[model samples]
Target chain A: MRTVEAMLVAEVVARLCEEANFVLEENIHSAFQRGFEEEISPYGKEVFAQLLSNAAIAAKNRLPICQDTGIVVVFIDLGQDVQVTGGSLYGAITEGVRDAYQRGYLRKSVVNDPIERTNTKDNTPPVIHCRIVDGDRIKISLMPKSAGSENMSTAKMVNPSKGWEVIKEFVVDTVERAGPNPCPPLVVGVGIGGTLEKAALISKEALFRPVGHRHPEEIKAHMEDELLDAVNKLGIGPMGRGGRITVLDVHIETYPTHMASMAVAVNLLCCAARYKTAEI
Target chain B: MVIKRVNTPLTDEVVQTLAAGDHVALSGKIYTVSDAAHKKLVQYLGYGRKLPVDLSNQVIYYAVATPTPPGRILGSAGPTTAERMDDYTPALLGQGVKGVIAKGYRKAEVLQAMRHHRAVYFGATCGIATLLSMYIKKVRLAAYPQLGAEAIYEYTAVDLPLVVNNDIHGGDLQREGRIAYAITQGN
Candidate 1:
């Protein structure tokens, strides 16, 4: 068994926290540029240009692109072959997040209560998902989910009879209803099958895929393409200014479900898709 | 409803000329508040208490931000979803609030309030934190010190960009944009 030191996890998480907040990933950048070139709406084109400019300024100046930095969500893949030596894995990751927010001048968004909400000062105790895998390396993915988009995510458990048409309609309807709210030209992650919770998890996990990448399964990938075409046709445009490109991409992931259940989850990631990954 | 647009760094003349459906990119003094502060302000106004800052012709950004480290003025201080403040919006607009900066759709009552008050609602691009931060020149706390990010802080912004989602004249850009873009073929 390979022993991964807790400090290594902390260090990686720390670096990831800062990088995710400070930089818009290159994939998203390139995707926006593509959107800019394809956008017919003069307003949409201008908005894309400004978005590119916004990213550039943020990267060069080490500033966050948006004011809502968001809640920290970390997914860890620990190979069964790997054991964390020294300190708890979760503790280290949380500490890393806490330190990164403080050191990188990122905002601490975690609050104490859902009712009498109050900021917790340090962005601590991130919503972490740990999975045991087959390899020896430890993989960590950080996604800072902004409230604007996260608030709009939806999930439905349909009867198996509801089938593909229902799924597509629901997904399309969700995006249509979302309109400019989730920030148009959105990256939509659809998780089909699985249990109710697993569907939501995979939907979010699917968002970590690069902006233009497609799922490996041919059928699933085709559905993604079809969904993309439909959503873009909605013309929510860039920033919902009314353009041809309402959705930049649609990613779908699925798992076999119980015969009676067909769980559908739609997770929306806005243009500010802030995430970073590291392996140790 | 009459719809329009206003570019940022607005002058008072531009603000006054703004009719319904006129979308504006606003600059200058925009205050930040969220659910907690909104409740406080409403209560204070009920008692005829003077606000920390005069809200006349001012814009309020519906947001709850993370705390920044030492030396930095603020941290990812982007607008939160505006619909959450629907309950308090009409009251604030009644009290001379000229505009709102946020993300997402507002309730029907909020839209009505915007029409009645001749106020506008603008949506900053969602998740664009770094981009939005550059426009904020300074931050000054005004109320609800205990709320941390939910505190009412005044922000001086320069060319703080936004798109008209719901204009004063009752044009809903988000609604129109969706219908305009709906897929028909094999949709």
Candidate 2:
């Protein structure tokens, strides 16, 4: 069995947090470039240009791409053969988030309570999801989710008989309702065929997929393409100023579900599309 | 398509002349507030308490920026969603708040208040906080220090780019833009 120190986990999480905030991933950068070229509205084009420059400024200066440095969402794939030493795994991850937000000059957006809201100050207790995997290596990914887009996410369970057409319509409707609030050109993640909560969780996980990549299954890939086309046709455009390219990409993930249920969830990631991954 | 230059403490005449879809480069002093601060302001107004800062004729930007890094006047600062502030905005407009800078569409009540008060709503491009911060020359926390980033701060902004989304003349850019570009079902 391999032993990984809890402090090392903290260090990795801290570094990932800072890096994700400061840099716009390559896929998202390329998507922005495409949006700038394809956008028909002059106003939309101008917004895209500003977004491109914003990404550059954030990267060069090591500043956050957006002031909402976001609530930390960490996904961990832990090796079954590895053991964590020195401290509890959960505590180490939280420590990492605290250190990164404070030391990196990132914003602390966490509230102590949903109601009677108070700042958590350190940005601690990240929403962490973990899975046990086969290998001896641990993979950690950080997705800094901003509330603007996160607030736009939605989930609904449909009758299994309603099928893919209804699912597509639901996805499109969610984007239409979101309009400019989530900040287009958005990365839409759809999770299908699972329990209610699982669908929501997988929808968020699907956002980590590289932009423009499709589901491996032929039918699901087609659905993603169709959904993308319909969403852009809504003309929400970049910043919802109206133009071509409201959505950069649509990703869908699925799991087995009860025969009576057809659960679907949509998670919208804004143009910032901030996420990063590291393995050790 | 015209880009107009505007200054703070927007006058009724200036706001009345502005129309939706006009690009603007706003300069001069502006106030910043977000969700928590808005709630507090409404509560203060309800209790008939004097506010910490004067709102008459002042422009407010909906922002809760990151902590300022060393040697910087401000951190990545950009517009937040305006919809969340809808409930408190009408009351603030009644207090003579002349203009608001934020992103996204507002509720009918907010538009009504703006039309009634002859105020205007401008939308800064969302997700471009770092770029937007370049225009802010200075920032001073003006009230509610306990709210942290949600504190009401006075900011001096220069050439801050924004688009007029709602104007006093009853024009709405969001609806117009969508109608102009949305593909018809048959097509």
Candidate 3:
């Protein structure tokens, strides 16, 4: 078994936290440029311009892309043969998030409890999803999940027979209702299939897919294209003030699930679309 | 779009003149308040206690800025979702808060309160935090320093870009914009 030091994981997570907040993924910028070119509304074009400018300022000045630096969500692809040594893996990840928020001067937006809603202070206890995967190296994908866009997300189960049409309507409805809340133009990440929880997880995972990149499978990729076209047609535009380019892109991930269940989730990522992946 | 340059304290007369869909370049002292601070303020009001800051004719932004590093005017400061504070907003408006800044739809009750109170809702483009921070000419803690980022901070913003999402006359830019741009299936 390959032994990896826990402290290294912490350090990597810390770096990912800072970079993801400070940087907008290249594809996200490309989408913004694309949106700027195609957006019909004069105001919509302006929104895209502001977002692109915002990304530059955050990177050059080392400020977070958005004031809501958000709760960090880390997806860990842990190799089955690897052993984490020197400390608890969870603790190391927490330490990394804590350091990034403090040392990097990023906002600490996590609250310890939902109802009580007291600030956790350091933004520790990030929602880390670990999956045992092939290879000896651990891969970490980080997204500082903003509550503004996150609160606009939704998951639902529909009858398997009537799923396709229902899901399309559901997805469109969500974006319409979300409106200026999530800050369009948005990159919509969708997960279809699996149980409810699985759908939600993969939906978020789908967001890490570079904006505008298609799923590997031809059929699934086609679904993404179809959904993207439909969502953009909503005319929600940038900042939902209305125009073309309501969504920058739509990405979908699918998983096999119980025969009886047809669970779907939609996670709307704002134009900021901050995501970073590193392997260690 | 017609751009309106305005400064606070926004009075009833100034707010009444503004309308939805107007682009605004706002400057002057804007206070930050969100989530926890809203609860505290409303709770304080409930107890008939004098609030820490008088709300009359003030522009309050519904956002908590990130901690500022040395030599910067302010940290990344952007608006949060406006809907989350819908419950607390009527109270603030009742207390005479004149201008509100945030993104997203507001509750009907809050809209009614804005009309009754002669206030306006401005949307600072969500996720454009860095760009917005550039408008912060100065910032200082006003109250609830213990709430950290959620603490109320008095900010002097210059040429702060915003859209008049809701005006005291009950015009809603979001709704109007959507209606104008939403193409029906036949179209």
Instruction: Please list all clashing residue pairs in model 2, or write none if there are none.
Output: none
Compute each candidate's TM-score over C-alphas.
Answer: 0.91, 0.98, 0.97
Which 10 consecutive residues of model 3 chain A have the lowest summed lDDT? A228-237
The DockQ-derived docking category for candidate 3 is: medium
lDDT (CA) per prediction: 0.79, 0.92, 0.87
Consecutive 10-residue window with the lowest summed lDDT within model 2 chain B: B175-184
Measured by TM-score, the strongest candidate is 2
Candidate 2, residue B94: the lDDT equals: 83
| CAPRI rating of model 2 | high
Off by over 4 Å in 3: none
Candidate 1: C-alpha lDDT: 0.79
Residue B72 CA displacement from its true place in model 3, Å = 1.8
lDDT of 3 by residue, B1-187 (tens): 6789999998777787898888999999999997889999999999999999888899999888887888887889999888889989888988889999998888888888888888898988988898999998988889998887788999998999998988877788778777777777888
Candidate 1 residue-wise lDDT, A16-39, digit = tens: 988887788989999889978988
Q: Identify the runs in model 1 with alpha carbons over 4 angstroms from their true place.
A: B1-16, B19-25, B65-76, B185-187
Better of 1 and 3 by lDDT: 3
